[model samples]
Target: MGMITWNCTEVEEFILLGLTRRPGMQIVLFVIFLISYVISLKGNVLIIFISRISPRLHTPMYFFLSNLSFLDIWYTSSIVPKMLINLLSFKKSISFHGCFTQLFIHLCLGGSECYLLLAMAYDRYVAICSPLHYTTIMHSSLCIKMASGCWIGGLINSLIHTLFALRLSFCGPNVINHFFCEVPSVLELSCTDASLNKTIIFFCAMLVVMGPFFLIIITYGYIINSILKINTSVGRKKAFSTCASHITVVTLFYGTIIFMYMRPGDIHVANQDKMATLFYSVVTPMLNPLIYTLRNKEVKGVLLEITRKRHVP
Candidate 1:
């Protein structure tokens, strides 16, 4: 059972006016998005495959990277493909339940990515701060538990947010201005006082977003300090190189996320929102495999050897 009414009793479906309002913009969006989707899937899937097949990558860092790639695949799978279809269709409509389902799955996957990054940061911290203990701290069993915990934790957190939305009294005007069933978008359609929902969202943001950000800041602050104490130039350079790629990825992922959600809802532009969705959805997934793997010589060597053998044979 559910409860959420605005002014009217029913709203069967919603029109998704994705991205741009211009009639001619659909074609451009389609071509660009199609390429992005293919690249995104290929990039993320290749990482998981490489991690599985390459014995050298059976370490704690790669294990988390594999899980991150898997999460990317699941996350992008939730939103981008359906969005591609909607670009061409004249009736860009989705049922209420369909919207909520999309909402749930998207949050489940996206939130998981947030936690995965945090885990990866911790991994980097261990590797750098306590080199002697890194192996012992991040064993296979612990790795599995950490990854599983991330998925479960993200789902529970997303569930709490989504249920709040489900309980709202959506009486009428079911048209969500944005491309997806974002919490703010759904809340806007409700007739009843959504102060509770707003409060919950704020609290969730503090826990999910601010919490991670603070922890990451502290981790990196220590990392920078540790790097400075190294006497040899080569040691400092080596230390900086090891963490540089991870830091870049973290910055890009969190920067866009902060920009998109941490704002007054009144200022939102649907097209900009769609583009913001693209950052974490399409771009970040493609980036993780390319950026992280490319930075690591071992993965690149393995990739080259595999490619060369495939071409030769």
Candidate 2:
């Protein structure tokens, strides 16, 4: 495909054509997203707080859960506040630096979560499949190293993408189609060829998204096999319960992500893209804390005990 040569000028700012153009709808969206953002923040914060204060919850599993909650808090924060502002604002413009900064942070946190989930899956795998050596294998030093590696890996991945995106020239029509600056949406406006960007995106998606995802699947396969070997029904149920929440969360998160990134570039639809991004970016974070806590007896018990103490006083 030949590059479309537009008048070459530096794009200093970008107009984010947000989720909706209708005035009435923007207000409604603002209200809805504000509530969602607040809930996501509070819920994730509560999980972090509960994990820290309760000694019973201090294990490899809860340790990873707390990391996940922390990541979710920043993941939602990186996008939602700007989205809420855009929903309420008439202009809906973001500076060029700001847009790419959003892109970097979003990708960093997102990539981090992918690896964190993989780490969590590995934790579950060790706990279930190697019950005898679980504590020794997932020791504190090892867990910390794994968590740090996830963050550092994500940072490196985001930095590469952001640097390449910055190099792309946006000479004209500096309008982003989506509510927030994302790889696909921003690439659409590039005056220069974005084939390389797309290629990098595909390559990185394999490394940061699909790679961990497939490993998780393999890890869970072993976990299921181990669960099946347990003699008693009650033992099997207990084993399955430990995994249920993580499976649900993985499905919900990775489903949207695969749809968004893994599909062919030619199959672009603005509305579908927006909705998919909204589900993963905004809605999933809000649901994660609920998924973890509601399904977890230990977390629930701790919450109940904390509530009872306040009520007694």
Candidate with top lDDT is 2
RMSD of each: 2.5, 2.9
Please provide, for model 1 over 164-198, each residue's C-alpha lDDT reduced to its tens digit, 9 standing for 90 to 100.
77776676886777666777777788877787887
Candidate lDDT scores, in order, read 0.80, 0.92
Please give me the total number of clashing residue pairs in predicted model 1. 11
lDDT score at residue 112, model 2, on the 0-100 scale: 91
How badly does each model clash, as a count of residue pairs? 11, 0
Name the candidate that leads on TM-score: 2
What TM-score goes with each of the models? 0.93, 0.96
State the displacement of the C-alpha of residue 215, model 1, in Å, after optimal TM-score superposition.
0.5
- lDDT computed for candidate 1: 0.80
Cα distance off (Å), candidate 1, residue 34:
0.8
Which residue segments of model 2 deviate by more than 4 Å?
1-9
